[model samples]
Target chain A: MTLSPIQILVIIAAVALGTMITRFLPFFLFPDNKKRPTFVIYLGKVLPYAVIGLLVVYCLREISFSSPAGWLPEGIAILCIAILHFWRENVLLSIGVGTAVYMLLVQYVF
Target chain B: MQSDNLHSPKKPADKRIKTKALKAAFPHTIPVLTGFAFLGIAYGLLMNSKGYGVGWTLLMSLFVFAGSAQYVAITFLTSVFNPLHALLMTLIINARHLFYGIAMLDRFKNTGRLKPYLIFALCDETFSVLCAKEPPAGVEKRWFMFFVALLNHTYWVAGSVTGALLGSTLSFNTKGLDFVLTALFVVIFIDQWKQQKNHAPALIGLLCSTLALVVFGADYFVIPAMIALLAGLALYRKRAEKGETL
Candidate 1:
C-alpha cells in the first residue's frame, strides 16, 4: 500500500516473470528434439527424491525454536504419518490423518 | 479411408480416453485439493488483511500461481517498493521448479498442444502428484497429467477467490489447516524413500536444509541449502561413478 498501484503491478509482473523463467528454463535448455546430457538425465532421476526431501524441510523451516511447544506438534504428526503410510500404504489416509492430528494438536494441545 | 470415417470415430475415442484419464487423475489430486484450498484461502485472507481486494488475489493466484512467492510478495507490496528484490526472491523461492521440469521432461514429451499449459501449471503440488502417480491402464498419460495440473490450478484459483470474497466471514477454527502442505511433502518423501535404493540424496537434502536453516535462519536458508544440496549430489555422483554403494 505504500507504493503506487503501478509499482504494485510492476512488482507482481516481476514475480510472474521470475516464476515462469524457472518453470520454462529446463525445457528450453534440454528441448525434446535433442538428447539430454548424461548428467542432466542423472540429475532428473535423483533430483525428485532430493527435492521432495528439501520440500519437507522447507515446510518445517518456520518451526519456532523458542516456543514452549517447540517441535512437538510437527514431530508427532510426522511420526504418525510415516507409521500410517508404511502400514497402510495409502497416500490419502496418511496425509489426511496426519493433517487432522496436527490440526488438533495446534488447535488444542499445543 | 473416407474423410468422415477418419473424423467420426476419432472424436468419441478421444473423448473416452480423455474421460478415462480424468478419472484416473482425480484420485491423485484429492490431497492437493485439500492442501491448496487451505493455503490459497489463507493467502487470500492475508491479501485482504493487507487491504488488497479480491481482484488482486484472483490475479495473483491466476498469474503468479506460486504460493510461497506470492506470500513473500505480500511483504514486498507493503514495504518500500523494490521490484528487483521481488523478482529475485521469486526466482530463488521457485528455483525448485527447474528440477521438477527436468524430472518431467521425458514424460511431458510428445504431449503436443497440452505441453505448454502443463509446464505453466506445474506448481509444487502438481509436480508432486505428477511425479508420484502414473496413468492407469487404458488412460492416456498426457491427459492424466494435464488434468492433475489443471485441477490443482483450478483449486488454487477458486480457493483464493473464495477467501477474498469470504473475507473475515467464516467462523470455523481453521488455525492449523496449513499443515496440510507439510504433511503432503512428508508423505511424498516417504514414498520416494521406500521406492529408491539410494537414501543419500534424501539424507543430504534434509541435513543441508536443516544446517542452512540453523545457520542462516528461515528467511535466507533455501538458496544456501540448494547450493549445499548440489555439492552433496556432486559427491554422490563421484562415489557412484567409482562403483561405491550408497
Candidate 2:
C-alpha cells in the first residue's frame, strides 16, 4: 500500500512523538539518587534474555512446520546454528553458515 | 567516616577510574557497529520497498533512529495514520526500553550534558554495552558511551543511505537477513549464560516466552511474555541469590 504525503508526515510525526515520550519517561520519573527497587533490578537482569527469547519465537511463528519438507531443513538449520554458536561462541560463522545452508535448502533441497 | 576523610583525594582517583572504564567499554563498539550496519540496511530496503526514496530514508534514520521501531513505523505509514494506534504500537514495541533505563540509572546518574543523548540512544545494542559492565576508573564513561552511540548511529545512517541509494537495482535474496538480530541475541545469551552459574533465569525466560508465543500469537505475545518472564525471574531470585552465596 502506498502512503500519501500528508499521511506519511502524520505517521512520521506520530512515531517520532511516541518514541520520544518512551525514551523521555525514565528521565522524568526517576531522579538520579533514587535507587531502583530490587524487583526492578531483577527485571533488568532477566529482561534481555526474555526479550530475545520472545523475538526468536516471533521469528519462527509463521514457518509452515506441518510438512517434513517444509519444516525439517529450517529446523535443522536453526539447530545447527544454535549448536555451533553454543559450541564455538562464534556468531558470524554460525549465522553465515546457517543462512547459506538455509538458502540452499529453500532453493534446492526442499 | 575516617575512611572518607582518608580518601579525600577522590578527584584524581575518580578520574583514573573513569578512564579505565572507558577503555574497557571501547571494544564493545565492534559488534554494535557491525550489527547496526546489517539491520539498518534491512530497514532501508523495507522503506525503499514501500516507495520511499533516499531522502526519506536518510531523514528518518537521522531523526527517528530507533532501529526496529523504524521498520514497524513503515507499516504504520502505509496504513491510515492513527495516533492512538501509533502510540500503542510504540509503547508495545519499545516497552523493553523501560528495563534498559532502569539498568542504566546508576551509570547515567553522574552524566551532565551527555545525559540527554545517552538516554535517547539507548537502543538494545547500546544497552547491551552499558549493561554489560561498570565503567572503569579514570575514563570519561560518558564519552565512551557517546562514542559507542555515535559509532552505531553512523553505521546505521551509512547503511540506510547506501541501501536506499542502491534501491532495487541490485536484487539479492534477503530472506535470512532478519536472523541477524537473532544471532546477536544468541551471542548475548551465551555470554550471559557463561558468566552466571545459574541458568535457571535464562531457561525460564526461554520457556515462558515460547509458551506465551504459542498462546498469544506473534502480534500480541511480546508484552505478555515479558511480563511472565519477569514475574517468573523475580519469584526465583532467592534461588539465584542462594546460588551466589554458596
Query: Which candidate number has the best DockQ?
Result: 1
lDDT of 2: 0.71
- Give candidate 2's error at residue B211 in angstroms: 1.7
The TM-scores of all predictions, comma-separated, are 0.87, 0.83
Model 2 agreement with the true structure over B143-209: per-residue lDDT tens digits: 6787677667777889898887776686776666655665566666667777777677668778887
- Which candidate achieves the best TM-score against the true structure? 1
Candidate 1 lDDT (Cα, 0 to 1): 0.85
Which tens-of-lDDT digit does each residue in B1-246 have in candidate 1?
A: 245332254687777877788889998888788778777887777787778879889889999888878888999999988899999999988988988999899989988778999999989889878877889887878889999988999999999888877776754666676687788789888888898777888888888788888999888888888888888888889988899644
Model 1 C-alpha lDDT per residue in residues A50-86, reported as the tens digit of each score: 8887888888988886885778899999999999989
TM-score, model 1 to reference: 0.87
Once superposed on the true structure, which residue ranges of model 2 sit more than 4 Å away at CA? A68-74, A106-110, B1-26, B133-137, B238-246
Q: Which residue pairs does candidate 1 place in steric collision?
A: none
Ten-residue region with minimum lDDT total, candidate 1 chain B: B1-10
